[model samples]
Target: MGKKEILVVDDQPGIRMLLTEIFTSQGYRVTTAETGQEALDSLYAGSFDLLMLHYKLPVVDGVQVLEQLEKDQFTIPAIVMSGLSEDIMKESQQFEIVKEVLAKPFNVEEVCEFTRSILE
Candidate 1:
């Protein structure tokens, strides 16, 4: 099979870069979006195996993006990342696509293992 593709969506440039680099190093095809619109655009434009989304964003928040996915009937799996991870986790329980909630200030190895567990 081809390498798994991951879309990393975050308002924070550093997080985006870090995830992109980490995933790329692990032999995945990674794309990044700084906004929810860009993430949705990427989702509509191509195929991705997983989504790593930030809870807080300008204009279109992560929940809004997940709502859009439901509206469009996209079944892509997602991991929601947030400083307020517990709040988002509780709120995101309704979305079947959200497989996990990752807290910010996360461990790099944990991120890798989680991705591997989900995709592999």
Candidate 2:
């Protein structure tokens, strides 16, 4: 099979860069979006194996993006990241596409492992 494709969406440039570099190094095709609209555009533009998203973002938050996609009936698997309290995390998981939630301080290794765990 071809390399798995991952769409990494985060408002922070550093996080986007880090995930892009880490996943690229692991032989995954990675794309990034700084906003929810860009993320949805990317989703429509390609067939990605997984979506790695940040819950908090500028102009249409992550939950709204996920909800909208779900409303449109896209079954893309997703991994959401957030620094908020655990209660918010619990609340965010109501979306069916959210297969995993990673806290803000997660390491690159954890991200890699989690991605493989889901996609493999």
Candidate 3:
């Protein structure tokens, strides 16, 4: 297979940069968006193997993005990142596309490993 493409949505520039750098180093093609609208645009424009998004965003937020995707019948496995992972985890269970919930300040290695396993 070709390099797995990941769409990472986070309002925080640092978080987006960190994940983009780590995933790129690990041989994944990473695209990032600062708002949920941008993420939705990217999702609608092209194909991606995975999605990683922060729960709190500027306007649309992560859940809104997922809801839109669901409404459009766009299916993609997602990892929801949040400082409040426990709560988001419970809330995200309702979305079948959400395969994982990651807490902020997470280990890069773990993220890489999980992503590798998922794409593999």
Instruction: Report lDDT per candidate.
Output: 0.94, 0.90, 0.91
Q: Write the per-residue lDDT of candidate 1 for residues 28-68, one digit (tens) a residue.
A: 99999999999999999999999999999888899999999
**RMSD to native for every prediction?**
0.7, 1.0, 0.9
Writing each residue's lDDT as its tens digit, candidate 2 over 8-117 gives: 99999999999999999999999999999899999998999999989988998898899899999999899999897386578766888888888888877888899999
Once fitted onto the true fold, the runs of candidate 1 whose alpha carbons sit more than 4 angstroms away are: none
TM-score of each: 0.97, 0.95, 0.96
Winning candidate number (TM-score): 1
The Cα error of candidate 3 at residue 9, in Å, is 0.6
lDDT of 3 by residue, 1-120 (tens): 788899999998999999999999989899999999999999999999999989998889999998998888878989899999989989999888888889988988889877887788
Question: Alpha carbon lDDT of residue 64, candidate 3?
Answer: 98
Collision pairs in model 1: none
Task: Identify the superior model by TM-score, candidate 1 or candidate 2.
Answer: 1
Q: Once superposed on the true structure, which residue ranges of model 3 sit more than 4 Å away at CA? A: none
